[model samples]
Structure formats: C-alpha cells, structure tokens
Target: MNTHNLIVGISGASGALYGIRLLEACRDLGVQTHLVISKAGEMTLHHETGLAVSDVRALATKSYKIADIGAAIASGSFRNAGMVIAPCSIRSMSEIATGVTSNLMTRAADVALKERRRLVLMVRESPLHSGHLATMKTLSDLGAIIAPPVPAFYTHPTSLDDMVNHTVGRTLDLLAIENNLAERWDGLKNARTRSQENDGGRD
Candidate 1:
C-alpha cells in the first residue's frame, strides 16, 4: 500500500467546497492525492466556486477522467491508504452502495470497499427519506463510513471557511491523516475555564 497516497472523489453535490478544501488540506500535508471528479461534479464545482475544471485538477497530485475505469485507483491492487468522497452526492452514494458504479469515482469507491480500505463518504444531503437512509445503512454494512458533513457547534466557527476546515479536518482524521486545520477539542473543563477567564476580563 502507498502509505502517502489517498484517493479522492468529488461528485455532484451542493458542498463542492468540501471536496476542494479536502484537496487543499491533503496537499498542504504533503499527501499524494489521486482525484476523480464526475461530470456533475465538474458542473457543481464551477457553479458553486466558479473554479475551472483544470484549476481544480491542478490541486491534486494526479487526476483521472470519470470514464477511465482502467485507472490505477479503480483496482484494489492500486494500494493507497484509502478513499474519501467529499461532498458525496446521494446518487453517487447509492451507486457505491449498490455496486452499480457508472464512473471511475464510484468504481474507485467500490474497489476501496472490496479491498477493505477505509472508505469515507461525506454525504451531502438533508431531510433524507427512508430510501436514502436505507442506502446509507447498506453502505455502512458494506464497510463504508457514511460521514455526513454535519457542522460541529463546539468548534465555534465564526465563518464558513472555519466550518469547512473543521469538517475536512475531521474527515482527514477518519482517513488516519494528521492535520491541524481544525481546532482540537481539549476538554469541557478547559473550555469552561477559558470562557470564565474571558468573562472575568470582560467585567
């Protein structure tokens, strides 16, 4: 396995920034990222961030086309640390869950599952119905981590970037990558103490 390599998938989802932030974080940490973006992903990336497809592709160590099922990351033998589908769309998640992948992104995810590698799907949907929940359950049963990008209030995010960084940092933690992009929770006692200290100074 390539200990320094990580497979990244970006699908058509509302939170395209999550995928971009993940790639930037990995790049900062010196991790080699193998990226694959779906057609809808490209559209969303542009619509949401106004970033060109080539610009996003330049962020990764390597990039693959969605139709390239023969790509190295599509094979279990490719040997990477694991795979992460940031801003994973419901359709993409369903494809992975059912093993009915239509593109290299989902194909790579399926390969990750078959290889017993950590597959983190940052599902980006809200007000999920029973069918969506069932699909998530199925993916979980098959060894995929259904980690929705739920914000952490404890992080006390003052801006959108903070929230994105926190979520991406937590996801990287799941991938076993060390990153200081987000503030770490020390303890409740420490938090209270800090709060009290600030209050004392305020008065």
Candidate 2:
C-alpha cells in the first residue's frame, strides 16, 4: 500500500534463487512486495530450490496468479516504487519489450515502463544471439534496465548464496532499495596504492 511497494516477477529462468533471495531481502527491509510467478517459474522453483508453490507464496507480502492481468499492479494508478523481474526468461522479456501483456507478470512490467518507473529485468540467459542483444537495447531505450544476475568477484564471494546476494543487492541498489546484503568495495584502490608504496613497487 505504501510507495515502497515492489512488484516481483519470477519467470522460467534457471536462477530461481535470485527471486527467492530478493523477496527475503525485501522482507528484511520491511518493504511490501507483490509476487507473481509464471507457470514455468513454479516448475523451476520446485526443480532447483525444492520450494513448493505455497512456499514461494509465503515469502511475499502478497501473491498474484500469473494470469491475473487485471491485478492492481497492472495499472499505472497502482502508485508503487517499481518492478523487478528476477530470473526473467527471454520469452517474458520479449513480451515486455513488445508491450504484449498476455499475463500479469508482463502486464505489471508494462505498467512500470509506461509510468516511467524503474523496471529491472534480471535476465537469466547465456550465449545470447544478436536478437537478444537488440531486444535488451530496445528495452533500455524504453527505460527498462537489463540487469542480469552477474556475479561480482571483487568482494571475494565464498559461496553461491554470496553471489546471489551480491547480485540481488546490486539490483536493489538500482532502485535505491536500502540494504547491506553485500560487502561494498571501499577504498580498495587506495589501499592497493598504499600497499605498493610499502612494497616499493615490487611483489
């Protein structure tokens, strides 16, 4: 109900954990989340995370059926912060790119774009063709952010959870969602300079 509301869309991408962790982070911040998972997203959740549909639903402040295109998030008048499609599939990306709102997931993304709100797409695909690159460009031109869950190793992540957390945390940063989920790189370059001075420019 507050302006801090975030609409989350989980598509059929492989990294279902990203979406799950994003919801957990939102709960940690006490930000209300509206979750909508595609049918394939449900299958991926069960396959990869072993989370039942209800389990995923329980992570959010509210859940919506994928086909519920008339949901509040589908309208620009919903007055929310923004939307993020974690583990967004190429199929769903195309739908949002073309303004084809076949379901609530893409419909909400459409609303985010039309209202000039932040729409972060955590696209989860690899070996992309030129078409994929071009669609992402089109979305960027339309003010949608193509934020794939790429891991940052400068923080020296120890595990998969660290990677996911850092990626999710960065995506939240794009929306100005306050969090300390990942270790920030603070003055590392300056520290390296001091270390070089101590070492006399030698190994």
Candidate 3:
C-alpha cells in the first residue's frame, strides 16, 4: 500500500499510551506521520509513559516543534490524508474549537479543517463539564470529529492492550484505515447462535 501522510498530535492527557500506540501502528503500516507534542504533552509523556521526548520522537517519520507555526503541515497546501489528536486534552480541544493556532498541533488541525480533510480528536477526559461539552459542540459544527478514548467491553477484552487496541482501531476506522485491532460483533454471531441452540435443546 502506498504510504499516506498523517498528522498526529499528542496533548496533555492521562493516556499518552494511546498516542504511542498510534505512532507504532502508523509506522507498522508504512504511513508517514508528522508528529507534534504539546508542552504539557511532553511532561505527561515522561510522567505517564516514562518515555523520553527523544524516544517518542523516534517513533514518527517526522517531528516538529509545537510552537513552530511555519511547519509545512500548518499550511493547507501540504497534503495529508488526515489528522488525529490522540488523547486530546480539553485545553487542546478548546484551542482547536476556537481556531487558536498558537502551536503546530492546533495549526495542523486548523489546516485540516479548512482544507476539508478528516480531523479526528480523540478527546480524553472524564465527567466533562458544560464548558467542555460546548467546546466539543463548536468543533463538531466546524466539521471536527470529537471522539473519546472510550473502551469497548462488547469485545470481552481480557487485557489492557486489548482495550487500547480496540479504541485505537475505532479511531483508525473513523479515518477510513482498515485494521483488525479487535474482533467485531460479526465474529460472535455464530457463538451466540450456538449458545441459544444449546439452551433450547436443554429446555
């Protein structure tokens, strides 16, 4: 498959692992990633994931300083398949919602929205307040997808990796990237049918 250019942003969320997983997945798929990490994200990367900034940067094909507004991805002319803000923080979401391109992360997202490209925000906050909801609504109206890193229990996940993979898989699905990170409901249809058959036979 031809490599597609993807813009990935890491914000100051508790789950930095999602961004790391996304980077690894993109690298494995031969996708070129333009990565940016917010200042808060840099601290969180070390605090939460215990990964050095340089180590994290090594995962992506290209890295850019978040404050660098002159980055290629900050312009609409630079073509990209899409942009994803994995573990997107509420602060970052507000920035994107308000068109504040102070950093490359938000600037890339702004370019994606203006260029009519897929802009997926994997917001990672729990028990959100009204302000957060309002920001999400604003972004939704601006054609940005506000997806949270909610886990899917229907897959009967047995490990932390399973949960993370499921969420990341759904994010990729939204971006139209085909991947089998977790089993779908279709795979359980036959098992459900067989269980029903056994119950009926016992009755």
lDDT agreement with native, every candidate:
0.91, 0.91, 0.88
Candidate 3 lDDT tens digits, 1-203: 22789899999988899999999888887888999999999999999878899999999999999889998999999988899999899988888888866789998998899999999999998898999999999999999999898888876677999999988888888888777775667767775775578679452
Q: What TM-score number comes out for model 2?
A: 0.92
Scored against the true structure, residue 32 in model 1 reaches a CA lDDT of 94
Question: Model 1: how far is 164 from its true place, Å?
Answer: 0.5
1-203: candidate 1 lDDT, tens digit per residue = 22489999999998999999999989888899999999999999999999999999999999999999999998888979999998899999999999998999999999999999999999999999999999999999999999999988886678999999999988999888998987888999887777678679453
Per-residue alpha-carbon lDDT of candidate 2 for residues 12-98, written as tens digits (9 for 90 to 100) = 999999999999999888899999999999999899988898998999999999998888888999978899999999999999999
Q: After superposition, how far is residue 149 of candidate 2 from its true place, in Å?
A: 0.6
Candidate 3 residue pairs that clash: none
Clashes of each: 0, 0, 0
- Which predicted model would earn the best TM-score? 1
